[model samples]
Target: MSFGSFSLCKELQQSLIEQGYTKATAIQQQAIPLVLEQRDLIAIAQTGTGKTASFSLPMLQLLTKGTAATDNHIRALVLTPTRELAAQVGQAILSYSSLTNLSTTAVHGGVRIEPQIAKLQSGVDVLVATPGRLLDLYTQQALSFDKLEILVLDEADRMLDLGFVDDIRHIQKLLPIKRQNLMFSATFTNPIRLLAEDMLNSPATVEISPETSNLEAISQRVHPVDKNRKTELLIHLIKSNSWNQVLIFCRTKHGADNLVTNLEQVGIRGASIHANRTQHARTQVLGGFRDGSIKVLVATDLASRGIDLSRLSCVINLDLPFVAEDYVHRIGRTGRAGHKGLAISLFSDDESKQLKSIEKLIGRTFTQTLVPGFELAIKPIVDESDDDLYGNFEPDPTYLKQTQKRSKHTKSGSNRSRSKRR
Candidate 1:
């Protein structure tokens, strides 16, 4: 159905039309009505499902109809997990509120607090902030939530996974118990459900899709290779297949940097994004990747959450994530907004457990192929302790050596001597 079906303000309708969003996504259609009715909501939808606008549109309408609060007292507070998401939601708020005089500001860490304090001091209608920075300001008496009419926890699952549960609970204590509460997340694990039980009061539940499912438009493939040969295979595939505009996911900041270095050495112009880099560096890498100046953009899970790339064609799993649910989010970056995309995973024996978990989460077996000339002669070392169906029992000398070293170090000198003598 079209957004016109909802009784939104003419200004909001006009803004939607200008933004070229005439039809409501499934989540939007289900969520907007419940939100406008002042009911608490628990929304579950996959990434790239237009969940952001579902709450943003209704929130702008509600705040605009109500009286503005005094300085430093925000009427609406949106808490997101990451700075990029906070900025994105803040931007969405501004876009929807552009027709009116409602003021909005984003408060996040990794930047100075003085400017955020200055903005709050002047006054704001809606405040979008990360939990840590918001709490810092709250403790300093730089902002107030006493007048809060609505509390939104965007990406609640990620917030909890990032160990922000205590922070969120503290923030909840600061708000009035009678205010409307909305919790939105891409996945609803058991932990997320328990958190929702605590935060939402008889909330209207909205589920647009099953949990931990990937977009249908994306084609997923796995290439079996040795851990040492993954980089070589990646470069070969990119160069031979002429794949450009690829977003690669690495598990660590150091891995991202090392991957970029390896790609450059192989004549592939690449950039990396991680928490260690300055905000400017991250922005530049993202900008370059979007505009086609950079061939490959390697990043950690932090980059997987909030960066939006409309034309990202390929996503490579340089390192499998420890958490299986994250695999859904990593590949989601490519197949966005109904566009077809490709997700290629380079698997080593060391990651068999992670791969099996991912396969189970997606509810299907992935097609495994070996790239020509890059096939691994040595099998991967799957932990025998894991009961994964896909687990292959292969011995790894490195792991064995480490295990032996640990055992030797743990043994007493008398026991070691007895064993050596025997």
Candidate 2:
């Protein structure tokens, strides 16, 4: 369906044309009209389904027919789980409202609060923010919800995952009871439903199949290797395939850092984005990765929430997430906007549980294969006599054999020189 059928303001129609957005996706078609009618809505959609536009476009259309905000009071509020997602949603709203008179801004932690306060001081028609930062602004009297007409919770499931239920409830108490409420989540788990029951009043529902839309465009593979050899196998795959851009997921920030260090040692330009990095550093890394200057971007599950790169072709799971739904979000980074993509996961023996959970959640099993040269081998038993005075033991011959076999594929000859993207 075309967006023009919605009879949006002329400015929105012009902005949509300028942004190259014409056809509306299924969620957009279903949710836009409901939003326009001011009906409370519960939209279940994954990333890459044009879900952002579904809500943003309609919200902008509605706000245009109302009075503008003043005295740091916002007319519409978009709550996101992460700083990156907040910024992403804020940017999308700004782009959609570029030709209109509405003002939009995003606020989150990890940056200076003064600048965000300054932006709120000018008042905005729409405010996209993380819960913590929004509360901070409210406590500091930087903004008011008195003028808030619409309340949106994007990625509601993620907010629950991050333990923001209490904060959300507190904010709900602060908002006017008459405002319209909209909730979007990848899945309608019981917790999400309970939250919705508490927040919405007889809301309409919209849903998209997770497997059909999000995963169908992406090719998936699982390489079963020993836990210690994942880095080695990943290096081999990238160098051998000559992959120009890859997004790798790690379970922890420390693991992400280590993965980047290993990649760079092999002449591959890589960067890490996680909670430990400053907001400025994370933004810079994302810019480099998007522009194709960085070969790899290693990130944690939480830190990867708002990364929306349309052309990103490859995603690797260095470590499987503890939660199954996160696997969906991880691979969702690629294969966006009808583009075919590849998702590779390094499955180790210890992560079998995580793999099973992910398969069960997605309703499909993966093709498990071993990298030819990096196959897992049984370690030979070593005698106590092998230990030296310092209690150090020699390398196991079995492990050494596997390492040598893999080294042949990772030889320096294939280590082509590439300039750093930093």
lDDT of each: 0.80, 0.82
lDDT of 1 by residue, 192-253 (tens): 76777777777787766432123777889999998889999998888877566888999988
lDDT of 2 by residue, 1-422 (tens): 89999969999999999988878877788889988988888887677888889889899999999998988899999999998899888988999999999999999999999999999997899999999999999999999988899999999988998999999999999998888888888766678877888888778887665433657899999988888888999999998896668999999989899888889989999999998899899889988988899979999986657898888879999998876667778999999877899999998876666776576556577888878998777532334363341121222233233323433452211111111111
Model 1, total clashes: 1
- Best model number under TM-score: 2
Q: Which regions of candidate 2 are displaced past 4 Å?
A: 379-422
Q: List ranges where model 1 is wrong by over 4 Å.
A: 211-214, 242-244, 379-422
